[model samples]
Target: MSFLDFLASQFSKLQKATLVESFQDDLDSSVTFEVVDRKIPFLPLFDVRRLEFQRGSSYSYSAIYLNKHLRLQPIYFAVQRLTESFFPKLSSLGSALVLGCAGCSIPRFLALSSKDCKITGVEYSETMIKIAKKYFIDDPIYHYFLLLHDDAFSYVHKTTEQFQLIYVDLFLADNNCPQITSMDFVNSISSLMAGDSIAIFNSLCLSKEDCMKFASRYASSFTATYVFDHQFHYYVVFAKTSSLSTLKAFEKRAMNFVRLDERFIAP
Candidate 1:
């Protein structure tokens, strides 16, 4: 690895370790803290607590400030770019799906941004769902959000409903869920997408070789794909149908939500 890359990795590790350590210290003091152990093999103990902590469950899937602190990590900034900064029409979307509801962070953003948007979040872990409902979801009628305790794979295949936008943020502790990389699953999901639909696929802990190759292969499943690398280790893949290609200068069309700091951006 290059010297700069090594330094960034070390910095990221140190930051996460420090944040998680502090969060662990507060676990005993709060009554809201909920701990859920592995419901299946290879899953680690998932901890759900209230506020002020940067999210780092399982591995480092997504990091964001909870409660009032609001230190939205880079991956979330990437999500903001993908969701808020990609499509201006997202505000009017009728239906949306979030495959993995980690802390329900992105869905929260979606619900708030699009008043008319109806979101259906699928999470396998009941504990996470409970935590999300308590901390993430805002209102019952206004937000129009629903959380389902089911495997994302089965739900996507069986659901008769279609969505305008789909966010695939599925991951376990350290490894990504197997279906995230499956072509058959992607094809099944494609069937549930509207004509102008888009799907955001996140693959964390990616090597440069893996990122480039995976981007090329996965882009084939859609009309076009946009790849954004966040903090070296994470790759956010935005794949959309061919109809979306007609939009002129689509990337810059979506308005800015947050002005990201230079320190947080990847080279």
Candidate 2:
């Protein structure tokens, strides 16, 4: 390793981490779920709680957040940063749907960020839903969120209710859920959207080329489509309206939400 790489690795080892919980779901023994709490090395005042799922040699983090203190709020996770900046402009919207409710982070964030946006989160794992309730969805704001234990694919295909905003974040241990890239899933999501609506997709696991290709394949279904790069992560957005005034407004407001100094954004 180079000098900087060596230093970075050593510095990472300094953080104190505790494995608070671990379990292998009976439904899927291939993956193990864990919840961890780790203190920032130099900044002892802050701690991060993370929920991770591991399969064989690969792993995926479902949620990460600094321990909440009085009035101090830190938005560090890239997905949360994107959500914080992206959702407010759509405050007039009444409902949102989350395809994969890992750790309930997005659901909780959406509820807190937009009071009127009733959030519905669907997760396949029963244990995951229990864990989310026990660990993440404790705040009063979550009253606006209705978390269901069901396969996102089946739920999407069956739910007749439409949403003004939809967030697709399905993943399994660093691997993209097979259905997320499928045409059926795409069509189902399109049908679930309101006439004037937007969908945000998390494509962090896909390469830039693959993300672009995937976005392009689905572009014809939406009036406006955009692929955005933020802090080395990529997100694809689709809107039903011909005009992109809301998206443009988000660009200006995003500066306030994504400035480097406000949050420690390193993964």
Candidate 3:
């Protein structure tokens, strides 16, 4: 199938699955979620909060947000760790883009971590964007955010602006969007990145073999790549240039994240 066709098919299927149902599938602990807010869409922009029983703290996800602080999920902690570690001085960064914009967590975190950083989220779901603005982002636009709307690919194609940080965390329901695995899409996205930018991808897979296959394709699109695996998921970070120096800077901060995210790192 063509790229747009594939995305449409997956997106249609995801819309059939409610956001609450998707989160339910992801968190299968019989825990109940207290509804915070919701918007009826093809996929309901349902926001709910629950106590992570194991962790003994409340967490939330609505199509996106995973914590009150809107932090990256533990599964995606490395993406944040690497971003933090690589930057050294976070405020030096200028802008960030979050593809998929699930609850706008990355943008939220970036705002807190860097005052100068402007964050733009590209989300296909207008309902999701509305939910985010009302619930998570809650920020006055034209100043902090360019806003989170539009087809991600179209936005990538038209925007002349480049970003220091780009997050590729698109998902439809519980499935990873098929288009994200393509090298063509990766290359198109790379064109919108700054010279020293980093792109992090969240890949969902049924097994390690699947992760490896996708990682190989993504690795070819960047100068250097790092893969972190957990269960059936693989997260990859690709550096556009200064591969060695970039990894070295990231290594200096490795110890900072090793303890917290180590358990999920598959052997």
Candidate 4:
């Protein structure tokens, strides 16, 4: 099967996934959390577990587990693709910051992608941080990862240190953090990026107009802005320079991200 076809199959499997474990955090009543397992039909051995948040009638897959031994994320396909493709360009950089510490999937991926790069992740929910540690990042591979239990909004405003790579993924279930599209948050992210660095935002769960508006907010702070639609979700990229075109050139390997930046600004 083709790459798109394979993606469609994976997406279908998630939609029909079976619930494996369901539980609640007594400390946090903001959202109900669950652990689910999804596998290809008729392949019981090919199992992948995921952490999800139940919001009303919908579910958002926050992290996916291939195996306890592997430091990779199957749900964050777009961020993984963009980072792997763009990280090499910023060779001088050795630091990355992830605003949302859901399962530390992005941090884990960053660690494996660049061993020298120091990774820091901040999560707003203390319970969520505990859940990540207990379920996802218990392995010794995360010994060097700095995990902070703090609100992303407050942390960004107070942080003075800059990083070559930053990721914004503050989500509650399928709903995004309302502050994610605010000017203050955008400016904070801009301040965190070092020279010629890049930032990736998980812009899903927003309407098309809202997504474009959010991307436009970064145009004044960054040299180029690009948006990619992969796995039925939108991801926005902001960079100090126009280095993201390489991603468009290698669409086949990257699973063909539908570029939507042209609708608002030229990148």
Candidate 5:
């Protein structure tokens, strides 16, 4: 069968299997409470607060709340793709920062992918941070991960620290992008980077126009920008310089990503 046909068939089977129903049930069944230090419960569905979980030693999910309506599907897909494709290339970076780290999911993935790199995560909600720390403990990957409860925009504006990789995934809701995309905010983030820094921005509402808008905003501050779409999500990569070395690094990293995971290839 053709690839599209196969995808459709698989999707049909998934729907029939009641994937949404199963997740909803899991969310409903998961116990909710408070814990001290490192033992916390995972909430897979919408509740008064965001959900947090620690899977084995590396993977985890932290969010403000679950969507019984299943709005986070795209975010999960984008995070998975980024973890598989972008994390491997960041081994050499000494430091990294994740903006709008809801449940610290991306930070956990970064920790697992490169245990030696130091990671600092900035989050706006204290409740979310409390849930994340309580549920997501310090594993080998998390040993180098630090969670800071603060507004992402304020953190970027006030901090002068430079990192090799900067990741932004803040959002208003399931479908809305945050106001941090303004030119001033983008410029502030750009100023926090070193000579060879790379910034990755995640946009949930994916469309050609959305991609162009992000690219245009990023272009105002950065010397180079590239946009890619996968599984209905838009990703924009910005760089300080359009050097041959930088381009080569991106190509090498992308190729290595494709080699490591078949899902990394553009669909």
Candidate 6:
């Protein structure tokens, strides 16, 4: 590696170590983490009794932040990486929907990247939405952002509006992505998408076989499907408009963004 690259790597390692040490000290305390937004203190009230960051293959960091000091570490890194890589296309669409938006990370990223796009996020957890609005959502830049506190399934079944992009990431406690993998859910999502719309499903299942099963089921409803594997049990399922040319265009946009921002790297 070049000298500058090596230096940056070392600095990143140091920062991670420091953060871990601080997290350990605050594990027993009710600590609030804040993100800077125009010098405003937007703190997420989490009793983060436990926090762990694991380094997986492909230079990824998987973080597990527990509420009751539990040591339950779920699949986090791969999903985050995949979302960052595919976010350009997901955000550039005219209208989008994000189901199971915990803390609204993907929605915030989308809003920041494509200010003109309309984003509707459905989240069951009111507390999570509150935290997301405070820390993640930028009201000024994202005038078209709408957050709904409701069940994902109910929202998809009721909403008559069509979307150009749809993202789903549903999981229960202890990293278990329930068998909400029903055909009805797939049909509901498909009916709500536009002609060239795309749907992305994030799963914590590591096996390619399992991921393909999910993709195939989704493909049964949509026009086409593909899976982006980000090692460590994180899989991104893309449905509809599976043209190779379209995918290549999306990848080119993602690569360009990666070149501009070092924090964004695809698996």
Best model per TM-score:
4
Positional deviation of residue 219's Cα in model 3 after best superposition, in angstroms: 3.5
lDDT of 2 by residue, 1-267 (tens): 235334534565666879889878656788888887776577544555668776766344554444433111222244555554555564555899988886876675566566778899998878888788787787776557888889999999889999988888887656678678789988999999887677778877777677677777777787656566666566776667544675565556655544321111111
Least accurate 10 contiguous residues by lDDT in model 6: 36-45
Top model number, lDDT:
4
* Ordering by TM-score: 4, 2, 3, 1, 5, 6
Q: After superposition, how far is residue 197 of candidate 6 from its true place, in Å?
A: 1.7
Candidate 5, residues 1-267, lDDT tens digits: the string is 335334433443233111111011122233232321221134223221224332223222343212323222222444444434433455565778899775565666566556587898997766556556655443444667878878888888888788877888785434445565678788888888777667877765556576666776556566666665654456776766546665555546554322211112111
lDDT of each: 0.56, 0.68, 0.59, 0.70, 0.55, 0.52
The better candidate by TM-score, 3 or 5, is 3
Superior by TM-score: candidate 2 or candidate 4: 4
> TM-score for each prediction?
0.66, 0.77, 0.67, 0.79, 0.64, 0.63
lDDT (10s digit) by residue, model 3, range 162-184: 98888887765555778786766
RMSD of each: 10.7, 7.3, 12.5, 4.2, 10.6, 10.2
Which residue runs does candidate 4 get wrong by more than 4 Å?
A: 1-21, 25-30, 37-46, 55-58, 66-72, 89-93, 242-256, 263-267
Better of 5 and 6 by lDDT: 5
lDDT score, candidate 1? 0.56
Write model 6 residue lDDT over 135-175, tens digit each, in one string.
44534656688999888988988999998778887754324
lDDT of 1 by residue, 1-267 (tens): 335334434454333222222233222232222322212122112122323323444333333333222222223556666564556666686888989885676666676567788888998866566555554564553367888989899898889998877888776544577667677787877788887776766666555566556556655556655555556545444445454344334454432332221111111
lDDT of 5 at 133: 63
* Candidate 4 structure quality by residue, lDDT tens digits, 82-110: 77566544333489999988667777777
Return model 5's CA RMSD, one decimal.
10.6
